[model samples]
Target: MMKRAEQKGVVENEAPQTSQKSKKQKTCSYGSVFGECDLHSSVDWGNLPHHVILRVFQFLPLVDRARASSVCRKWNEVFHIPDLWRRFEFELSQPATSYLKSTHPDLIQQIIKRHADHLQYVSFKVDSSTESAEAACNILSQLVNCSIKTLGLISTAKPSFMNVSKAHFASALTVVFVNSKSLSSIKIDDTPLDDPSLKVLVANNSDTLKLLKMSSCPHVSPAGILCVADQCHGLKELALNYYILSDELLLALSSEKHVDLEHLRIDVVSENPGQVEFHTIKKQSWDALVKHSPKVNIVMYFFLYEEEFDAFFREETPVTHLYFGRTVSKAMLGRIGMNCPRLIELVVCANGLQPLDDELIRIAERCKNLTAMGLGECEVTCRGFIEFVKMCGGRLTQLSIMEEVLIPDNDYSLDRLHLEVSKHLGRLWFPDMMPTW
Candidate 1:
């Protein structure tokens, strides 16, 4: 019995030893396999050509490029390049508001510090929430100290905290004007600017400002606009909305020497000229403005209570682009084609079409440079479209017809129209069903 027990213990000990040896062999094989896989799978960061990597980064959006830099140690080193930062700034400003909102404040400051010397354009919005007025002022101060040329300020949000007297909002504005020596264009939205405020802005930076947009500013009056026209010698583009625009202001702007006005946009509610009674003085003012400023391109959005289309269409101003909305008659279209020979683009939105087919054809024939035409929510048939295309097939590159198709019978006409358009058209945009052809 003792001999049998000793033999069993010895067998048990030998079995454990054999199992341990097998387990060690398996682990070694797995380690070898894993090592080989890692060596083959690893990206050769050093072997990647510099220009190829830079081109890849250039294709990425600004935010994605920043993210790519964080992928690894080698990638993180690429962020130090100055040209990369400049390209990022350019792409970042394309979607200004969203980019500003997504980027961290600290990261923005870091970017400003690193690439401030190369900064050319900066657009930022400040609301009472998200950031304090003081913080906004600080950021603007940094940018002004930089070489930024274009500045856009949009105050979309109202004051968050009730401490209006203690707020640094005014100081922020002061900092903007004081440091913005290189600013050429300025766009301010949703802010009321009194005459005094306008004077301060113009007095400080009028000489350098080339374009100014003060849309949705309730406190801006005709006086303030005239003040800008008089003072800002280099002003080229002016956009005014919600503010009162008068004939006197237009007259003053017209008489200025070498006005250099390239673009003008005005939204006004006027009850004058050819509606009920012709305001000769206002008409003369507009005529003189257009005639005197040979280079100026005018865009007016006026709301008249009881004015005929003839009142607005009488001015034979040379416009590169024309857009008309509200209750416009088909007869007026013919008048416009006869008057504005230099018109290149026409965008019309009306309720019904009385007899504008001949007028449209005339426009296509006359305006050889006519590249785009937008007929929005108008009563237009596919047959009329086919006729227009046949006349201006070579010049018309873009035609947008929205909400015009009424009947199932028109589908066949639409199909034919699409086939004709597909031949000469390089780009086609439709709001409804996609074109079959």
Candidate 2:
């Protein structure tokens, strides 16, 4: 009986070993060079429709896009497709010593050589370093057959970008401007673009140009901007500094040849340190602009010294979106309410000890289309805030007032405020609470 039981146990162990050996044989049938692989059984994402796959790839960042190209043989072919390479952005990092991943010049050259002809939209955004800017312009100069539709140059580092020479930047950019036949929109902030480059840009793409945003471009004079305004009749959007804006430029934009302009953005930055001086665009000019393009949105952004506010709202200004970078006074808020009748959005950084009771009420009364607002380190009574919300109604889509913005008055009540505001806002609303940090 013992011998018979031992024979049965041996049979059971042998059966399990045979099954394990067969599993290994099945896995090894794939014929991997080093080891077995399940290549035949894996999902084949490459079989997705070509257009659908390209659309999916469009949402990936440049780094991820490059990584995905190495996934498979079919994917490698799809990665080099011209359509997929049309719109590209170079997020060039700082130098290697600074511990940032800088773009390689050889990679830029390879792209220019291989895919320049297929390029339609391109932007060069560099960190605070001269080498990256050099690489950007170098890449630009080598775009031999490129016919990009939209070109944008941006600098993440504030002061270092100013270091690149205007001549070198312009020379390389002119190569692109002159080459492309159907350039439409451009954004070249903090670059040293001059009048000659403007002339070249307008000469080549006057008819096709629609949007131009060149803020902080000190080298380009009012005439340079005016030239663009006069020539580019199809231009719908423009952004420039205060110094570049003038009566002539406004009229040029509002001319009969030009279509009803859509948006005009002005950066009201103080040119000098501790300097309160500012150049004003007369109310008459603004009126003429409104007359020509009745629905034009005049957006003004103020980054100024406290004293510079005087020159801003002397008379009624047609400002739609207003932002005050410095501490704004109740006086300025009062002027904003009276003068900025067309204000659609207002962000006040600060108002002194006295509550902005009348100012807030007056703003709510005047600016009917006030959709979004933000208050930081400001003083306002709870009653005034409630009234403003009620008047503005649900149209106040994005009301971002900070916690300390509400001054403790007799009417201050967090629960009551929340209840009243939520009823009008169409959602639960409360003042932005102070951060623990």
Candidate 3:
């Protein structure tokens, strides 16, 4: 009986070894090269369809795609596909300052050599370093044969492109501007993009340019922006600083030859608070623009002191979106409620100790189109805020109120404020709680 038991144990161990061998063989069968791949095999990984491989490559980052291409000969071919290179963003950075991974120089060279013509939508993301900006400019200088359509030069932190030589930057940028005849969208904010370069850009891509966002560009004057408005009649969206906005530019855009504007963003930044006096647009010019492009959404951003707001919202402004980035007064808010009838969105970052109950009620009474609102370091009684929500009801798509902004009153407590606001908003709502840590 002991001998029988020993034989049974040996059989059990041998059975597991045979099963392990079968699994190993099955794994190896799918791991072979494409040349040895069999379509009839139960599972043939190397023989996946070309489109399938391309789809897989699309989801991978550039570096990982390069590594994955070396897995097999077929994958390497897919890596070089023109479709994969159509839209590429070159990330240029230095290790000392930026945490972003810089694109490998060799890969960039390879792309410029092999896939420059295939590029259509391209962007350069650089850190706050002159060296990285120089590298990006160098790459742009080499893309002489490319036909990029949409181009964006984004600074990860501060505007580092300002450190680059203006001549070098303009020359390199002119290469793409001159070559790409069908360029449509360009965003070159916070760069030393002067009026001369702006002329080159409009001279080349005037007919095809549709959207241009060039804000925080001190070098570009009102004449440069006016030139763009006059020449690029196909422009649908425009964004620039308030200093560059002129009544003549608005009149030029309002001409019959120009297409109806869709969106306009004006940044009212106060670098020198008391010294900077902003010019107001004539009401006739605004009326003409409204008559020409009645549906245009005018967005205004105010990053100025309380006194600096006197020039704005006094007249019947057509501003649809208004944002107050500094300490705004109750009088300013009251002015917005009275003048801005087309207001759709409002965000107030800071308000003094005065509560905005009357201003909120007036806005709810007048601005029928108000859909979104956000209040930060401001005071509003929980009862008043609830009343405002109730008056705006279901139409208020976005209501963002800070927890501290809403003071608990007799009718409303901290616990019940959200429940009341949610009922009127037709969605579950909660005040943004400040993080303890």
Candidate 4:
């Protein structure tokens, strides 16, 4: 009996040992599977050496390119490549603190150092009103030596900054035009700039300046613009909004030296319209201006009264591009169509008019090369759009039906519209209404 009990004990011990071995084998198998899986899935993508990655980064916008560089250490080095930020300026989301923390100041310094020689465009805005002008000037000073082709400045009003007599104001202007040898385009808004200062800047760089835009610059007068027209013979495009524009200035623009001006925009200041009264100009003046400057291609007259438009159209002149905002009627459009047979672009924003689609269609039919058309805020239906497109055939390249027509929900109408326009249309814009691409 004792021998049998001892044998039983030994058997039980062996069974437990076998069970332990099985558990150990299962654990090992799991570990091996996991190890192999990780080895296969884990990859060092950043370590891959290829110029394609840098090229891809170049294709991305400035902000995205910067983010991509922040992914890893090697990428950060790649972001510092001088050529990446040469053509564009980058602004970080955070204020100066975060920018200093994350990015190397040397990179920014290098950008500023090589400004005019390498940079093409710049967009800058300041967060604090009190600090805006000074901060903006500081940034501009850094690019003084840059051959910047385009500069856009946007700012807000603080009583402190509103006083233009401050030293910061002159400093900003000086820095902007200091060494802009190759500068061609400049746009400024809501800042204090006087006529004399503007003349000085234009006279300094008059040879290279091609396009100039000044908006809400209360101090700019017709005389200042004439200074530009007289000095900058190479000027091709000009947009002035909420400034003083007079018939005398228009007459100056018609001079032989400034006749090369192809695109012109003049927005009258409602409060100061008395300074440049549209109704006061004689019909003969308009005719003389057109006769003197036959090369003017695009003309925009904003906030003009109906009588002023009548005077303008009474003159027999050829207009290739015309935009009449708030003062055009169906009868006026028809008169314009009869006068300008070579009209290639027309923008009409006449509101509260009965459907003038019939007149528009007639104008489209007459203007054979009508490539772009903008019917702003006028009441028109999809049927009018269809007929207009049909009338233009393949000549219409850009069509903007803003604030009026409703695109159908189904694909049939959209498809038909697309089919009609696909042959010649390069861009079709409809506000708040998405038609199938």
Best candidate, TM-score-wise?
3
Report the C-alpha displacement of residue 395, candidate 2, in angstroms: 1.9
Model 3 bad stretches (over 4 Å): 1-42
**Candidate 1 lDDT:** 0.57
Each candidate: what lDDT? 0.57, 0.77, 0.85, 0.58
| Better model by TM-score: candidate 1 vs candidate 4 | 1
* Model 4 poorest ten-residue lDDT run: 9-18
The TM-score, computed over Cα atoms with residue i paired to residue i, of candidate 1 is 0.62
Residue-wise C-alpha lDDT for candidate 2, range 1-437, written one tens digit per residue:
12323222112212122243443343344234213456454533546566765775677655555544444434445566788878888667665634445544444555776789999999888877887787788788888688899999878776545677888888898889999978999999888889999999999999999999999988999999999999999999999998899999999988999989999999988756566466778899888898999888988888876666777787888788988777777788888888888889998776667888899888999888789999887877788888888888999989998877776567758668878889888899877888799
The residue-by-residue lDDT of candidate 1 on 244-312, one tens digit each, is 556776666676563657888765444454434323225567577777676677665545432444455
Clashing pairs in 2: none
TM-score of 2: 0.85
lDDT by residue for model 4 (1-437), tens: 12322222112212122243443343233333223423234434456464656776677654445444434445555555556655664332235523211222334554565434566677654443445445556666666566667877654333323544545675677766766656688877666777867766785788888888876676777788778877787787787763455566666667777636666665543433344545434455455556765566645555665544444455444557777657466677777766667678888766454676666777777778788887765655556666777778666766776544434434336546555455435345334453458
Candidate 4 residue pairs in backbone clash: 115-146, 116-146, 116-147
* lDDT: worst 10-residue window of model 2: 8-17
Taking every candidate in turn, the Cα RMSD to the unseen true structure, in Å, is 14.7, 11.7, 10.6, 16.3
User: lDDT tens string, model 3, 1-437?
Assistant: 12323222122212122243443353354343222544355654446799988987788766556655544456567778899999999999998788888876667877888889999999999999999999999999999898999999999888599988999999999999999888899999999889998899999999999999999988899999999999999999999999999999999999999999999999999977797998888878888998999999999999999988888878888899999899999999998889889999999999978899999999999999999999999999999999899999999998888899988899999889889999999999999989999
Off by over 4 Å in 4: 1-56, 60-78, 90-120, 125-134, 154-167, 241-262, 268-276, 279-296, 304-311, 323-335, 338-342, 353-437
